[model samples]
Target: MSTKTPFKAIIIGGGPVGLTFAQCFSAAGLDFTLLERRETVTPEEGAGIAISPTTFRIYDQLGLLDAINKIATPIPQKHVMTKDGHRYNSYEFHLRECHGRPMAFVHRHELLTMLHSTLSDDAKSKIQTNKSIASIVSTDHGVEVTCDDGSVISGSIVIGADGVHSKTRRLMNDLSGHEEPVFETTFQGMFGNFPRAANVEEGSQMEPGHDWEVHSDKISSQCFVGRERGWFIIYRPLAPGPTRERKTYTEEDVQAFAKDLIEMDLHLTDKVKFADVFKVVNKAGMTQLQEGAVLKRSFQRIVLAGDACNKITPNVGLGYNNGVVDVVYLTNALKKLVEDAGQTEIRTETIEELFARYQEDRRALSETVDSAARRVIRTVTHSDFVKYVLDRWVNPVLGLDKVYGTKVMGPLLAKQQVLEWLGEKNYLPGKIPWVHRGLVAGEVKA
Candidate 1:
């Protein structure tokens, strides 16, 4: 297959998004070499990440669901509370019944490790770490990537999964003579993990809203109790400014930030304050949460995926999930193109058409996700009076949350994309039938 098609991919970055693309390319029988700037693919960082049923279906098709389930804790329950430790609402997710798979929460590092470990040996052999991309030049025949160490690698297309501060994105802009910023950072985030707090039940997620007594309008918090540990993320709005440049944080910065939040209650009971969790935190980091989709997802033969192209607030947990969706959409399209090309080399114009559709499909969904996540973060933080009323009163009083779960989100989940070439096994079919059904092997093409 590799020899048949002139479509080898040069994938940049080694995070969850890049790694997922690698696996998808391997499954599609497409050739790709992944170059990660980090020394190791699975860096032991970050608190937790959620895998939704939308993404679970893809993992199942890729033969990764079982391994993921072994390490991930399925979220069964959720609670919404006020800063004074008052639980306002509680409910079960019912994800499995509705979508066939539950929302699985796992430590970020563990998820990365699982993805890296499960890749085929042939696929694994193509991954190269400690390779930082210096520049990208696209020719009529292919794209060439030059590393900082003077190494050059060429491929039919270059994919940028290098994340929010994407070097590939920057270089692409440089080539096109565009200087506008790709994303905006409106909020700064802090995430950490600690030993499970006592009385915090496993499989439960807690969202404790603003502290009206102290900096109430300034922050929003979320915590999940996994089987072995607890993970938490706090989001605070940054002052309006030119915040496109990435900021680095130090230990002192974290300590100073934690000091302000130390007295905040977890809303489980009066006993569990932010201090209790902070004192035992095994790993923690601070980051600026960039939001927006890039204006251009592709230039010539170079394309962008994952956080490099679109970024959303983590409060909705759609950031990584959408990235996986990007993989499915992209791999399916590229696979079909390669197979259809037969003995002919794929032209740059044909690749442009593929990327145009890819960007259109992805941009639509990403825009919706970005809007929802932005609204959620704003509402949870009580950023405005209307949102405050919506979050504190209307949502709970009118049971809008449940309505959103069953009506709005349900249909979206049902329409979640899949690998078309791989076809469907319906491994996790539920009450809700998928809109885009895949054709099984040896089945008639629709």
Candidate 2:
């Protein structure tokens, strides 16, 4: 008779990061279970996600590149302008030329569906929805996670891939006796999507699927017109007061906010105002942009990943991609730990050491991305005179855009994390070379 292995990983939340944990754990030949609070897996937000080469390269390794490529649209150029309708610059960064892949945008729901469908049947069977976590206890031998439904799950570790308002983070805090806030809200935003407008044509100046960014003294807006859908976001800086605290918005608040944005000029096409976009909106949301990085992401056998730990402003589009990198690193570390321990139960002390190393390796990079995102949002919104001058003159006049895109952005993308158990494949080739190649021939990086 064969004895069953005592190592099992429990993943909390079923969003992109959670699903990714499921997939990666499966690929690493690890036993895991995923619990989602929602009844269904599909997200109702219906927003668009920008998939940079930094992310798609990992997707390629996971065998998800072709499916995402089919549904996603390429964003080749970005047009920036002032609120007064003065077109400052249109930089065709040639993202494909720089990184062998152009930035791609896709609806979040479609991406989630594809991610869920691609999982193996055994992996799919392990995902349980409507299972909200009520409590988590880390024992010497393993972890015991109790759900609101009175169900109990025993796992070697708990990975929290939940969102910014993560319950797992709260539970970990309670367990550790710390209650300090993890993120700060700097900007509030309203975003929505609609079917493609009639005026947007394929080859015209108002080309369908064109990316445009308009900036003002205290606010900035982004518009992306796709072949089938159009997305818009207006970000406004909040005053430094107690009211800036994050809170849920009601439908009434959202509608009133929409009214305030109606007269705003978009500079997308001839005399286009936000009202035109609002009239046909299929879905919209008002959100507070929280920005920060947690210094400690894991407590004993419970580890936090993705938005649950690091919250970045969305202007830079690095939040999810960075979270994916966290998953990759954590997955690689856990895979090694499990393999090394063989069929024996992983000790809490050993897990703590592994978690410490994982946090050390990831914290600096996470902070860098966090700082970059904060700066980008501030510069675009002209939060200060220095930021205004940098965005309005210095960057354009000095051609720092190209420098940032190549010199700075290229290296960052090149240094992204990958699954170490899976050997690295040279699918993405450009001028920059990767610093950390995935494990090859069972040879580990020293």
Question: What is the alpha-carbon lDDT of model 2 when measured against the actual structure?
Answer: 0.80
Question: lDDT tens string, model 2, 18-105?
Answer: 9878878888888999999999677778578778887787787788888888878887878788875677877765567877887878
What are the per-model numbers of colliding residue pairs?
A: 0, 1
Instruction: Give candidate 2 regions above 4 Å deviation.
Output: 1-5, 200-209, 240-244, 268-271, 423-426, 438-446
lDDT of each: 0.80, 0.80
Best by TM-score: 2
**Deviation in Å, model 1, residue 419 alpha carbon:** 1.0
TM-score of each: 0.92, 0.92
